[model samples]
Target: MTRNKLRLAIIGAGPAGIYAADILLKSERHFDVSIDLFDHLPAPYGLVRYGVAPDHPRIKGIITALREVLDRGDIRIFGNVRFGEDLTLDDLKRHYNAVIFATGAVRDASLNIPGIDLEGSYGAADFVSWYDGHPDYPREWPLEAQSVAVIGNGNVALDVSRILAKHPEDLLPTEIPANVYEGLQRSPVTDVHVFGRRGPTSVKFTPLELRELGELRDVDMIVHDEDFDYDDAARAAVAGNKQVLVIDKVLQQWRQREVGSASRRLHLHFFAKPVEVVGDEHGQVAAFRWERTAPDGEGGVVGTGEIREIPVQALYRAVGYYGSPLPGIPFDKRLGVIPNHEGQVLIRDKESGKSRQMYGVYCTGWIKRGPVGLIGHTKSDAMETIKHVINDLGNWWRPESPSEESVVELLESRGIRWTDLDGWHRLDEHEQALGAAEERARIKVVPRDEMVSISRGEV
Candidate 1:
């Protein structure tokens, strides 16, 4: 007697989706499973490739582990195949035993403040995508600003601040694309103001990231002495959390340093909550107006009615990322995640008039849980989702057409140009060869058409 094989389809080839495939394949449940990872782009490793800052090669190193998983050959990668346009939820249900959506958030979460729509005001997500050489974003970025303001205190805010203040030549050692390098070279930015709504102890930045700000060459890290005012709650947080302690220590050291004669400066402002983005006559960002905040004794802050204004040529909001709704998934617009309970998707029951699980469909990563944690957090999240999947394995709907070849046949019938694992290898070699000529790690292909062409072996 032959054992039955399970067919799984995972959308979005990012860390979350890939990690799920890895866990499912490595499980000791004694069931044979085949996973087909699908991605809209012509490459895998979604955020690791597109969202991470080019200068942080250490963070990008996570790709090495992800690459090993893909190279295992047990899992199949279908690149350049979109979830909605190329294939639908119905199509997935027809061919796979179960579906997992790991499409992580790519857009910036809105900051609903006045003047946020000003011409010079932009989302940090767009800037990050441009600098990371994402294929979908435009090649050129408006970098003529002399001074900029970055709202938020997370790693992304740091990335935006560092990219704005650092000398363009310093980024050459990394795998920054030609377009991004050129854009950075043209930047006239001299000062970067980073604002946090809470005190220093409540900042979201990790210690290593905070320390790196002070280490940038020719950029003075300036932390105002007044910003160090922490209440009892803030002090308690610093004592309770090791990361907060490290961040506080790093900021204190920066505060004690005498202002160095650097061409560029990065100013850290705590307890400053942006109330409005002031615009000039032409409707371009001219300055930022923020209200002072004080600890509310609950690890949060309250406005103190004291406002201050800082002149800036541009503003970038890096508050957070939000996921978009898939074609047939139940999405919580407010939370920016799929409506789920323990990884099982929830939908409104027509008869019962209550929320219930949508059998056989699941979600993981930022799409399941709101985008909050780092890449390391994705592993544990995936484990939780996978456990739910395993528990529902017995009840998964049986498909009329479950063979792996059925998916290929469907794509062919739809005339969709999909690339396989071999295509990714070809594109990978092409990029590495380009990098070899330049004496760098790898130069990313910046254009979508070019990437598709290279992946298809046309280039």
Candidate 2:
């Protein structure tokens, strides 16, 4: 084995990408190693930058740590560059010794139902993106709505509803985009309902997120007593689990207060499955036709035929995120991922049962293993995959025959424009300036064009 460092290209700048870069940059074998970090957004920190709720300052602090990693002299960051769109897999394989795909699952799972195409129906991802001021989403909170129904009971559903029910004064201090804050200040909605097809015991919200709902001053919280008819054993099973218990406690606390005087309402409805989304004359969601459901005694749910309709103008679906196919990667439609053995991108010969290795191509994050784990899980995953890549570096990088693919040349030839590390500094300055002008925490540009133009010196 030669005493040479490996040249690596990491495809995403989120937790997995940043953590992997951190591991490589901090390694003892620094002599021949270099890294190029690529991201579609001008800014990095994948989910922490766009996916996380704006009010969550604690989680957003991870961005600062990631910035330090990018500051390392051995690393190069290419922002506003997408793999499929700008850089191809073939291109990536040639440019770097090994490429790590950390492009996260950004799409939301669809709820296939009639009238889902209605104007008011929105994916939780889109709603979060809009309010979080993700540069891609046009600046606006569609809260002129009178009522909203969020389908699915997860932390994200809670996040969407909480932001809706929260008073503008309570949210203003947070880093929400100015336009979102303004639209929310005039929200017409009086009630926001969070729904679940299952009972409270199966709800996926964390205790920290559940408790935050209690601090909302403008909205009244409610959980129907009928939602919890679980046997004594089931109740005892969840008694110590803080997340489930927090929901129980919050429901109890809200029940004690007189509810009518509250300006807005946040209702938690369980055992309800949406049968159909009812639309108005103008093709907007007017109401949701929900059927009561209960456990079918075999870990399944059965509807009780009892139906109820609730008026609503907007809906957010937070079921889950699903992966999409990337160019030049073997995609498994059923699994919503590129088939992999550990972190190596697995490609199988169609005629034979044998698996072929796609050399210099690796994957991490939700796309590698199904999108299930939290942010911290990515670190261990990236490390494991990175070990494998680092081990195989000898096959690619060599002193005499070092690969000749230059990222700068490739980008220039394709007319795929991007900003180098210095360009990101300018974008950073612009965002900080916007935040300063607003007298709030870091303000963000939520439009893709704005970010691209700013990096291109058009702004």
Candidate 3:
């Protein structure tokens, strides 16, 4: 009387999905369990490929460790397969004993501002996707502007600001597609502004990322004195940190240099909320109308009667990423998460008790939780979800008929060539080769056409 091995399909090849697979594959009790991981991109490593800034090769190296887990005999990698688009939730439930939706949030939260729909206004996701060489984005980008306004204070904003500040020779090393790389080299934009509604303490950027702003030998980092007026708690966040102290020292240096410089500038502005985006006659953003804000004593911004006008030709709303509705899963639109207790997927009617009607349907990462936390934080969140999944394995192993389809078979039948560990190795080599050709670290293939051709057989 041996227990049945669980059949699992983890949709999403991001950090959460990869970590979940890693843990499950390593667990002795789950030796018999099999996993088929799916991702929309031809290449694996979701955010690692698309979200992280191109220049940060060290952060992208996490893929090497993930590649180890993927090499395990029981785990399969299915790239270039979209979950909801190619296969339905019900379709997945019909095949595997359990399905884990680790699909990371894909879309950005829209700013519903008056002129946000203008041609020059873009979301941070698009901005990132463009520069990072996401296959879906076009190779040509709009870089012929003088000033750009990015509305967020997160690491992403920092990344965008850093790239904008990079000298062309420095940028030549990363895998930016030829056209984007050329466009950036010819970029007319010299000033970048990252705006936040709150003070520096409430900013989503970690201290490490903030310090990178000072690394630019050619770019000036400017912080208005007015923006640093934090209240007690907010002040405490910066008082004792070595990184914060470094940031303070860097800003002090930047202040001394801000008076007159011809170099590109990365300006961090706080306590200002965009009330409206002013657009030119051609429907491109020309400037921004912002209202002054002060701390309301309870970790929020309160509007002041003061107003400020800043000239801008480009804008990106990097407020945050949001989750989209998945079929058959209960979604909480307000919270941007699927309804669940701990890590257990909760049914609308069965909220009072744990229900296992659907055998292997589960969720992890941003889709299960919400788009929050850094990559390291995803490990703990994934572990909690795996615990619930392992506990619920009993119900899926009953004496009834077994699932007929698994993610691997469906992908194979559809002619989707998912890269195994060896295949990814080849891609890694190819990317490095391309990088060498450009005399840069690694040049990314940004166009979807090129990514598809390379993944398929054209390259």
Candidate 4:
């Protein structure tokens, strides 16, 4: 007998997966839909809760909308549920009719260069994780460098630069926990240099983030005169795009401002492509070397062979975020995304190079399309996946036990102490209360077990 309802399991509880559930509910499908969201962490939001910097409250505001969706009492959420470990493909096969993987990328995209693995060198993603109170990363960070080099021009590069250069006192207003504030307070950092491979107009930075970089308290912004030689292509970009124009206006304003006498200084270097990370005798970061690049008149740059080396103890590579392959999913290692056509996962036969859909398996967000746009792009991404779910309803799994009660019973049998929506409420209130005592918005809980305990109302 055909079932009257659809049991859907979304592997991530972040914006991507939540958005997919929301779209499914609003879809004009004939069958009833039941969604269950699962996250590996005790919390729901993936990167929004862990990968985002502490000072970016505006970006974090997307949580309000996501929270509304989860709180609607229609969709169920299970926290601390690892897909491959706690719940396997066999488990999902029995419980749900279809599954969507929205596991967004967290690993840093590799930056291939000599001596890139020095002790003082780090990935910007790990730094963001540390400041955001991600429980998995170590609580301590080494902020011993007086001069630091940040290689990249995106928002993440700016974030790492701002956090390293800003006085620790300025970070007190954010939601960063006590440990992060204390770690930053001990920092001896004075000058932070940011390098970009392309010219100013060709930067990947958004106008808002670029402007915010100029507003850091007591920090002098420096843009070299040599880097301002914009080509015709650069000028065309500034004139054609409104966002590019605003960014150019800000950079030009900085160009005009007289260098002020501030204790900390942030230098923005454009048309500089990093070539090597020089290591000292002790195998620690000693300096950074890069080649000056010039526009090739084709919207790209060619190395000018003018190598420059800067003495710096620490370097952060903020190239990009790459996805992790799921245990049972067909992943394209080169692209760091599940092998998919549209949203339907396409698995290839190794011997024949043939392609076919893994029935009912779908992907969305960064895992689906690689890390590209912001939350707005994620909404449209989910639309693509859920559209397939509605159209390919005939291809969904026929579970042996599709009842919600059977799923609950299986979880209880496994000794999995998973968290539900009510548990999240408890943890949320606890964090808010902690922040209230300190006269701040919220103080994030940093321990996995502690978060689970609070969510379970054990303490």
Candidate 5:
């Protein structure tokens, strides 16, 4: 008796989704297994390719590991395939034994301030996408600001501030697209203000990210002298937690440095809670208003009722990233995640007043949990989801067409111009070729049609 093939479909070709596919294939199994990774874009590695900063090749190294998994011939990738639009829940149920929604968050979490809608105000996620050469975003960014405000203390805020303040010529060594390079080159930005709502010891920045701010050539690191007023709890955190200790040490070193007249300045402002974005007569961002905050004895901070405003032509809200809801999935709009219990997708049952697992459905990554934790933490998250997935194999979907050929036929029938693993290889080689000619690492292809055309050998 021959064992049956276990077919799986994963939405989102980001790190989380790629990890899930890799783990499942490597795991001990009772039957033969196969996976098909899907993404809306023609390329794979969703956020890793599109969300990361261009200058930080260190963080982007995760893609090499992800590439190894995709290179394996056992797994197939269907690119430029949108889940809800190209293939629905019904379509997935007809083909695969399991479906995992690993659609990580991309949209910026709402700031809900008085002047957040001003012309010069933007979401850091969008800026990241623009600079990373995402095909979907506009080619040109309005980098017309002289002074900018970044409202977050996380790694993302740091990335934005660094990119805005750093000389455009410095980014040329990386994979920065020509259009993005041109935009930054013309930017008149001199001061970049990074605001954290908590005290010095309570920032969300990693040790490496914080230290990198000071390393930017010709950019001065500015930390307000008063923001260092650490409370008893904050002081204890610095003495105890290893990460917090390193972060505090970096800030202290910056505070002691004598001020120099650098062409650009990157300011680190702690104990500042964003109150509003003040708009100018033309409804563009004129200034940023924030209230001073104090440590509230615990790990959190309380507003000090001291409002201050800074002159800034632009603002970026990097508070958080939120997930987009799928057509059939039950999403918690407030939390920006799918309702899941340890990776099993759940739906609220009106009669029982509780959530029950939606059979044959699961989730992992930022879509399952909120947008928190580092990329390394994603493997553990995938492991949790995979455990339930393997144990509950008996509960897998009974598909009408489980053969791999059926999915191809369905896609062709719908006229979906889906690119396979081979297509990704073509696109990858093309990017490298383009980069080699420019004497750089890799210049990313930005237009959607151009990427798809290259992948399909139509160009």
Candidate 6:
């Protein structure tokens, strides 16, 4: 690397971070550049590997494209390195010219309703992590419930309901871990009720995702015809959005289908808003109570006086994902995002009493904008952030030591065991070999210690 080379650090290896690196490398900049993509997990592809449902391999296929970007040899990968603990903003400033934070939202957003603290109440994010064999989550999940209630209308809510209703044997073909398979096998669930406040036309689910629910093996989907009674606002929305029209059509087809004798049943209930999660004597979830809702003629719904209660042992909330505050970032608590002006981080100056740009610091993905769109939306979000990054290149802070060797020395002096691209390839091969023995796609390594050990070549 030359003295004029710009050393960049991206603090996530997810879609957002990878896309940013790709754009930066492809940009026609005057100076040479070197990028280091960092992730806390030993593996890359953050959400695509840990957040997406395993059965949906099409969504997971995005990993192949991301893999090609890292394989281009212009970017370096630093896996299993935690920000704030392993390195700070000052540490990055000492080695890199600029830093981009792409750490995405992973925690479940709060709904702020009554009885939300009861036992047997789980967040869909945690459930997804467990089922997807995330190394950070617990290996065993309690699935002893016979009837479960899932609240939300997004693809995540549908994923939770479908996974609960689908048989364990049906998931064997996917890359589901052995522990998840065993945990789901013990589930006695026969009914999964999914509730949404809005009508079918206003649902957040993608048309393809919504249609996949109807094709699950041995699981019957039940949709009430009354739930499709849309108001003028919903009708107008469906008329304008082709996706909504397709969703409406698919839902209508399911509503007209004759009920089958499948052992497990998944009921989609619209026009219902959860009010409380009632608990039983043992402090576990006993029943779920919700109020009937009607369209408010504004693409929203208003709760009616009518209330309904259903007996259920477990409840999963999939309202949305919220970003966590980074150690040295200015975060907006209300929006669960880092405060920024067009991807340039904004900080209030103590002397001026006005918000000003934090030079050389940028944000992308859910941390820059709220978590709302699909994975494909991340590319455009990265482009916006990279535009600001390129604009600020003339004013970027020159590091005291910008060489790649300095970064390696810094991590080594701190005794941080970081994995590189070759390490990741070894772990990938290990997983594939494990999967080959089982005749599956790939068996995931569930334990964090094992992941670190494998990546570090200690096993």
The candidate maximizing lDDT is 4
> Cα lDDT for residue 17, model 6?
97
lDDT, residue 174, candidate 1: 89
lDDT for model 3, please. 0.75
Better of 4 and 6 by lDDT: 4
- Best model number under TM-score: 4
Q: What is the alpha-carbon lDDT for the whole of candidate 4?
A: 0.92
Scanning candidate 1 in windows of ten residues, the lowest lDDT window is: 1-10
- What are the runs in model 6 whose C-alpha is more than 4 Å off? 1-3, 350-353
- Residue 358 of model 3, lDDT score: 42
Candidate 4: regions farther than 4 A off: none
Q: Which digits, one per residue and each the tens of the lDDT, describe model 6 over residues 177-211?
A: 99999999999999999999888887888888888
RMSD (Å) per prediction: 1.6, 2.8, 3.0, 0.9, 1.5, 1.5
lDDT pick, better of 1 and 4: 4
lDDT, model 6: 0.90
In candidate 5, stretches whose alpha carbon ends up further than 4 angstroms from where it belongs are: 1-3
Summed backbone clashes in each candidate are: 0, 4, 7, 0, 0, 0
Query: Could you give candidate 4's per-residue lDDT for residues 125-208 as a string of tens digits?
Result: 999999999988999999999999999989899989988988888887789899999999999988999999999988898999
lDDT for each residue of candidate 5 in 5-57, tens digit (9 for 90 to 100): 77889999999999998888888877778798899999999888898899889
Model 4 worst lDDT window (10 residues): 1-10
Q: lDDT of model 4 at residue 187?
A: 92
TM-score of each: 0.97, 0.91, 0.90, 0.99, 0.97, 0.97
Which stretch of 10 consecutive residues in model 2 shows the poorest summed lDDT? 396-405
Per-residue lDDT of candidate 3, residues 300-355 (tens digit): 88999798989999888888888887777878788788767655676665666654
Instruction: Please write out the lDDT profile of model 1 over residues 231-347, one tens digit for every residue.
Output: 788788889988888888888888778786999999999999999999999999999999999889888999999999999989999999999989988999999999999789999
Tell me which of candidates 3 and 6 scores higher on lDDT: 6
Residues 287-335, candidate 2, lDDT per residue (tens digit)? 9888999876544578999999998888888888888788888888877
Q: Indicate whether candidate 3 or candidate 5 has the larger TM-score.
A: 5
